[model samples]
Each structure stands twice: as structure tokens, then as C-alpha cells.
Target chain A: MTKPAFIAVDWGTSSFRLWLIGEDGNILAERRSGEGMTTAAQAGFANILQAHLDAISAPLDLPVIVCGMAGARQGWVEAGYIDTPTSLAAILTGAVVVPGQSRDVRILPGLAQRAKDAPDVMRGEETQLLGAIAADAKGEQIVCMPGTHSKWVRVVDGRVTGFSTFMTGELFDVITKHSILSHAVAGAADMPADTTAFEAALKAAFEKPQLVTNLMFTARSGQLLHGTTAAGAQALISGTLIGAEIAGALSSAGQGAAITLVASGRLQTLYEEAFRSLSLPYQTIDADAAVRRGLSAAAEAIWLKNESKS
Target chain B: MTKPAFIAVDWGTSSFRLWLIGEDGNILAERRSGEGMTTAAQAGFANILQAHLDAISAPLDLPVIVCGMAGARQGWVEAGYIDTPTSLAAILTGAVVVPGQSRDVRILPGLAQRAKDAPDVMRGEETQLLGAIAADAKGEQIVCMPGTHSKWVRVVDGRVTGFSTFMTGELFDVITKHSILSHAVAGAADMPADTTAFEAALKAAFEKPQLVTNLMFTARSGQLLHGTTAAGAQALISGTLIGAEIAGALSSAGQGAAITLVASGRLQTLYEEAFRSLSLPYQTIDADAAVRRGLSAAAEAIWLKNESKS
Candidate 1:
């Protein structure tokens, strides 16, 4: 059996995932929980990690590699950020070590674009980008990483030129829960998703994204005027937001740059439908696999490869 | 003392304002309260309105004319809607009287655009439109009634064309209060308004309104990357929403239609600033005066003018 090499973890603001990798890059064990940075900050990151590691009975000496909000300022140890226009390789080298750990533990830094006109930052998606796009790949590429704060990164050759963060997911959450439209979409979760409303709204918003807020109001108005289903209202809101995101993401991107979407589950389904509705050709990479691969690459560079060389 | 001709009230979703108008069209008495439709729905609209009427020491027989959410389906009385492409005169004739009221109390109907592709409805603002624009106003005119849900109406040759509703204000409220960026704007209300930041964000979003969600994220990223103040984050979010609203409202409007703004207090100030920043010429009408005038017009058509004719 291949010996355990290192543990790769994705610790986001509200979620935690850990994987024990073998020497050959095979996953030996896995664990996921809600004890992300927020919970860990209160319960102690070290104790949570130990409990997860103990559940899998992993080697005590195995080092751990982490990314995402675990490295945020209010996170575990403030892993900091690597400013753009920097190479994906810079992310691997900027990992900050957690001092006095029983085993070697490091958190990958995020990327920040400090442009006055269009400032943006990403904590975990940089690693996903690091793995999603090949380091030596040529030509311009637009990589879309969708989540609570969906990020659209512009990659020129191997370097990350810049990126923009669209508050699509969080906006959807708040608007549907807190706005008057909340009443329109109250029973949506129990109903089947409305792809018809989704596609139409996606097309309209993609064509005239400035009218997005106006379009959102239609969710309520549509219900009142035409008895639109609660599910339709929910889908309409989602499509309008995602449609605007896609339009904004490509607004300044080089024409014909390949669109690579990195998302998982529901977001993946929605974005794919949006791309198809807009007739934009695109490719997809599973977000979980990409992040694990990115973390694996970082682990090899930080520990496994170094151990072999020595 | 001039005899009270009628009681004009603008009873909105969350606020109530009443004015006792004299026979010669002057204000004889006034009252304001938080007992809007929401509260009055539970406390009883008749009781609340009568209490205000009694407090002003007006004669018990003075009839009341109301326009706003009080006319909504969920409001005190379902006064219903006058579909678009009808004359503004139709609204004056559409008032529904409260059946069991001690004196004449009529609620003005809202406007509804039942277009399948762009459905919209507005309750209070049609009355504002009736007051803001002259009956024989020639050429195309665009009226903006800014509030929780801002309404932009199009009128051509004194006929009501169509309108769009943008959820800009509610979005600002929810986003700043519930989203992740809420942390970025926690103390913004205590800080001085950041007009500089507001203008910069306004121009950016106005120029590329599709990038609104992305621009909104900058509120948080700006603080993380450049130490932008809480007030600046608040202003940035506000600017982005308003900027997108303006762009959406005019995307298909006829070029150079006279812009009339009917808004009061803070919204009026902010919208005026936005128009100035965009170099769009516009004239302002006090929202209070417009609504009051509107109610008065409905009263004259319903009772006063009819009384004189008799």
C-alpha cells in the first residue's frame, strides 16, 4: 500500500473538507463538515482538524495543506494574499506555515487585484484556477469559478491578468429571503425547478443586463399578473443574476477566449443551462476535483517532491 | 378659517401622511404617522384614519381621498389596477369608495402593465404621475418616482404609455443589511456620506451596467484591498444600484424625453446627485406635494366638481 503523503483541506467560510492522500496521489480517506473557518474560529481549528484526522486514523506525522477562508484575515492564521498580475506558480510558493504544529501544516495564499477602477480578490478559487488551467497552457482564457461570490478570472497564457468577483449567490440568497419577492418564491424549494422561466430570464438578462433589477421585480409582477409559480419566481431570480454575471464576466474579456467553468452541483447545472441558452460554447471542470488536484500540486511542491529530492 | 374641502392622504406600505385641504386648495391641517398599510391592516384602516382625522379637529363629515398601498390587494381596500395605454384620466375615474365608511372615502387604483415579456405594477406612483405631469403636456415625458421600489413611467402626448419597476432601494436595503458586504458597511450610517466614492461607482456602473453585481462586490474588496471606509462601501453599493437603475430605465426610452423626478428627502437628494453626475437634465417635484395634489384631483373629480355641477 502507498503510504499516506499529506492531507489536503478546503476550509471555506461555512464548510470544511479534508482528504488524506497516498504517496501516489490516491485519496486514502475523506471527511467533510460544517466546521469551517467560522466554526473553527470559535471551536479551535487544531481540535477540529485532530478530530477529523482521528476519525480516519491518519498518521499523526502527516502534513496538511489548506486553502480558502482558513487563510482570511479573520481566519486561522492570516495566510495573506499574492497580488496579481502573478503566475499561478506564485500561489504554490506563497503558502504560509502554521508554526509549532506537530506535523507540517501550510495554508495557500489568495490572489488580489488592486486596480482602482475594478478591485477584486479571491481566497479559494485561485487554487481551483491553479488546477483547472494548465500552467504552461498558451493563449487567453476566461475561467469562471462560481460560488457565494462567483469569480471570473482572466488568464493570459499562464499568468492571471486580473479578475472580477460577482456577488451572484449571496445576492440571490438575500433578495429571495429578505426582499418582498420572498413572498413570491416562498414555496419554491418544495416545487420542481422551472427551467422555462430560467431560460427566458437568462436570455433577456444576458441581452440587456442593465435591466436585471427590473427583471427581478418581474418575479413578483409575473406572479401577480400571470400567476407565475413559486418555482418559476425562484428560477427567474437565479437566471437573471447568473445571466448578468456571465455578461459582466465577458464584457472586457478578449473575444473568443475559451470559457472554462469551474463549479459543482446546482451552480454547475444553472451555469451550463445559461451558457447553452446564450449559445456560448464552454467546457467544465468539477470544482471538487479541481481543488483537490490544486491542493495535491501544492502538497507535492511543498512536501512530497521535496522529500523525494532529499 | 377656510372650510376643509377634503382630506387627502398618501398611505404607503410603511408610512402614512394626511393633509386637510381648504376650499381654496391650501393646506389647512396635516398629520403623519408610522401607521401605514402594514400597521393599519392589523389595527384597522378606518380606526387609524379616523383617529388622525379626529386629532386634526376637522369636521367628522369631511371626506377622505387616498392613493397608495391602501389601494393594493393586500391593503385596506382592493381598489385594483388600471391597465396601461389608458389615459391618466382613467385613474381619476377608477377610485373605489370604502363601502361601510361613515363619510366618503375613496382609494385610487394603481397602474399595471400586463405585457408577458415585461410585466410590472405600481400602486402609489400613478397618482404622483397624475400630479407631476400636466394633463395636456405635449411630446414624450419620462417621470421617475423614487422609493423602496422605484417606478419609471413613460408618457406620450398625455396618454399613459408603459412603465418599469426597479427594485433598487430594496436591494440596497437587503444587501447592506444581510449580505457579506454588510460587514463592510456596518458603521456606514454613522459616518458622513461618501459622495466621492458614490460618483465614481455610479459612473462605472452607469457606463457598464451589466457589471453591477461585480461592481457591488468591489464595496467589500475595496475595503480589503485599500482600507475603504464603511461609509464609502455604503455609498458604492448605493451608487451601483442607482446607476444600473438609470441605465435600465432608459435603455429603450426615446432619446431626450423631458425627465421629471418626483421624490422627496434623501432619495430625492441621491437621485439628483446621480442625474448631475450623468449630466442628465431633469426637474424635481416634491413627492409630498405631488401625491397631495393627486389626491386633491381625484377628490375634485369625484365630489367637489360634481357638487358644484349639482
Candidate 2:
């Protein structure tokens, strides 16, 4: 068995994932839990990491490389941010080392766009972008990483020109759970996916992105007037948000730019369906794989190569 | 004191307002309460209406003209809807008489636009529109009724053409109360209004309505990165929603059409500021007065003349 070389952690706001990478650059074991920054902050980040490592029976001195919200101001450590326009490789140099740790621990910094009119910031997604896009990739590309805060990134010749964060997923959660539409989508979770309703709503919102908020009302009004199903209403909300996001993202994107969607599971299927329904071409990249690859790149750049040199 | 002629009530989802009108068309007495349709439905709509009537010492035989959600399916009586492309005067003919009441109680029907692409229904706003626009008025007019569900009605030559409902107010409420932006807008209600932030967000959203959801994220990101005040974040959310609403509302409006804003108090001030910031010329009408006028019109049409004839 290949000996574990280092641990890679993606500690987000509400989720934690750790991969035990071997010397042969393969994942020997992995651990996933709800011990993200939010939980870890309360439970102790060190204790949580130690418990996960202990569960995997990892070597005590295994060096750890981390990404995501764990490096945020409120996270395990303040790794800070590298402001755009910056090359993807620049993220490697911005890693903040955890002082006083027995083993080597480094957290990757986030990316910030300081444009006054369109001020934006992203954490963890930078590493995903690094792994999703090749260092020497040519031309402009729009990479969509859909989640709680879906990010649309514009990469030009391996450098991130800019990006926008659409509060699509979070808004959907709040609106469906807390807004009046909550009644419209009751029992929607137990229903089957309404692809037809989703595609229709997607097309409508994409065509008239301005009418998004208005379109959302249809989830309820449609149910009242036309007897649209709970699943249909849920799909309508999801599609409308995703559709508007895609439209807004592409509005600022250069013409003929390639679309690469970095997502997995349900989000991947939904976005792929949305793109297909709208006849927009896109390539898919598994989000987990992308983040893993990104953390691997950071690990190799920061520690592995140095050991070889020594 | 002049003799009480009738009672006019605006029964909404969460509010109830009744005005005792005199023979000379003046308000003889008024009562307001939180026992709207929701409460009335549970507490007995007839009993609630009777209690309010008894408090005002209203004539036992005094007829009642009701509008808003009282006419909804779940309210006192199911006052159905009048399909659109109809005249504003047509709403008066659609009043549904409540059965088994000692006094004549009639609930006005709402307006429904059954356009498959943009299906919409308004119970209370139709009455507001009835009082805001005259029956014989000429030219195209856009009526903006800002509230929990802001309605933008397009009236062409005194006939109700179509309308759209933007979830602006409700979205603002939920996003601020339930989303990540909640922290950014904490204590904003006590802070002074941020007109500068409001205007900037308004203009940004109006220019790019598609980017509204993205712009909403700025409420949090701006606070974190730019040290924006809580009031500024609150203003940003308000401006973004209202701006997108106005943009969407006007997108379907005819060229050279005038905007008639029907709102009162805080909503009026906020919407007026939004319109002024965007430099959109608009005329204002008191929402309370408009609804009262509409209920008066309904009373005059349904019972006043009938009593004299009897």
C-alpha cells in the first residue's frame, strides 16, 4: 500500500471533506463530515481535523493543506485574498502557514475583485478554478461553479480576469423555506424532479431575465390558477434563478467564450439540463474532482517539490 | 353628525381597515385592526365584521362593500375574478353578495389575466387601480402599487390590458430576515436611510436588471469589503429589488406612457425616491384614499342608488 504523504482539506461554511493522498498522488482514504468552519469554530478546528485524521489512522506528522472557508477571517486562519486580475498560479504563493503547529499546515487564500461598481470576492472557488482550468489554457472561458453562492468566473489565458457571485442557491433556499412561496412548494422535496417545468421556466427567464422576480410569482399563481404541482413550483423557482444567473453571467462574458460547468450530483444535472434547454453549449467538470485536483496542485507546489529538492 | 350610509372595508392578508361612510360621502367613523383575512378566516369573518360594525354603532341594515382578500377563496366569500381586457368599471359588476347576512355584504371580485405565458391575479390592487384611473381616461398608463407584492398594471385607454407582480417587497423581507445578508442589515431599521447607497444600487439594478440576484450579494460583500453601514446594506437590498421591478415593469410598457404610483407613507417615500433617483417621471396617489374611493364606487354602484329606488 502506498504510504499517505499529506492530507487535503476542503472546509467550507457547513461541510468538511478530507482526502488522504498517497506518495503515488492517489487518494488512499477520505473523510467527510458536517464539521466545516462554522461547526469547527465552535468545536475547535484543530480537534476536528485531528479527529478526522485519527479516524483515518493517518500518520501523526502528515502535513496538511487546506482550502475554502477554513482560511476565511472567521475560519481556522485568515489566509487573506489575492486580488484580481491574477494568474491561477498566484494562489500558490498566497498560502498562509499556520504558525506553532507541530506538523506543516497551510491554507490557500481567496480571490477578491475590487471593482467599485462590481465588487466581488470568492473563497475556495479559486482552488476549484485552478484545478478546472489548465495553467496554459488559451482564450476566454466562463466557468460556472453552482452551489450556495454560485460563482461564474471569467478566465483569460490562465489568468482570472473577473468573476461574479450569484446568490441563486441561497436565495432559493430562503425563498422556498421562508417566503410565501413556501406554501407553493410544500411536499416538493418528496416529489419527482419536474424537468419539463424546469426547462420551460429556464427558457422563459433566459429570454426575459428582467422578469425573474415576476416570473417567480408564477410558482404560486400558476399553482392557484393552473393547478401546477408542488414539484413544478419547486422546479420553476430553481429554473428561474438558475436561468437568470446564466443570463447575467453571460451578459458580461465575451462573445463565443467556451462554457465549463464545474458541479456534481443534482446541481450538475440541473445546470446541464438548463444549458441544453437553452441550447447553450457547455463542458462539465465534477466539482469534487476539481477541488481535489486544486488542493493537490497546492500541496505539490508548496511541499512535495520542496522535499524532492532537499 | 351625518347618517351612516354604508361600510367600506379593505380586508388584506394581514390587515383589516373599515371606514363608515356618511350620506354625504364623508368618513363618519373608521376602524383598523390586524384581523385580516387570515385571522378572520380562523375567527369567523362574519363575527369579526359584525364586531367591528357593532363597535362603530353602525346601522343594523347598513350595507357593506368589501374589497381585497375578503373576496378570496379562503376569505368570507369566494368573490371570483373578472378576466382582463375588460374595463375598470367591470369590477363593480363582479361583486359577490355574501349569503345569510342580516345586512347586505358584497365582496368585490379581483382581476385575473389568464395569459398562459404570464398568468397573474390581483385581488386588492384591482380596486386600487379602479380608484387610481378614471373610467374615461385616455392614453396608456402604468400604475405602480408597491407593497409586499408590488403590482405594475398597464391600463390602455381605461381598459385593463395586463399587469405583472414582482416579488420585490416580499423578497426584500425574506432575504433580509433569513439570508446571509441578515447580519449585514442588522439594526438597519434604527439607522438613518442611506440615500446614496440606495440610489447607486437602484441605478445599477435598473441598468442591468438581470444582475439583481448578483447585486443582492453586494449587500453582504460590500459590508465586508467596503465597510458599508447596516443602513447602506438595507438600502442596497431595497434599491436592488425596487430597481429590478421598475426595469421589468417598464420593459413591457408602451413608449411615452406615464407612471402613476399608488402608495402611502413609508412605501410611498421609498418608491418615490427610487423613481426620482432613476429620473422616471411619475404621479403619486394615496393608496389608502384610492382603496377607499374604490370601495365607495362599489357601494355607490351596488346599494346607494338601490336604497333610494326601494
lDDT of each: 0.92, 0.91
True contacts kept of each: 0.96, 0.74
DockQ computed for model 1 against the true two-chain complex using alpha carbons: 0.94
Candidate 1 has an lDDT of 0.92
Among the numbered candidates, top TM-score falls to 1
Give the CAPRI rating of model 2: high
| Candidate 1: residue pairs that collide | none
Candidate 1 residues B33-125, lDDT tens each? 999899999999999998999899978898899999998888988999999988897998889999998898999999999999999999989
Q: Which candidate is the best by DockQ?
A: 1
Off by over 4 Å in 2: A307-310, B306-310
Candidate 2, residues A39-77, lDDT tens digits: the string is 999999988988898999989898999999999888988
> Candidate 1: where is the Cα deviation over 4 Å?
A307-310, B307-310
Q: List the residue pairs that clash in candidate 2.
A: none
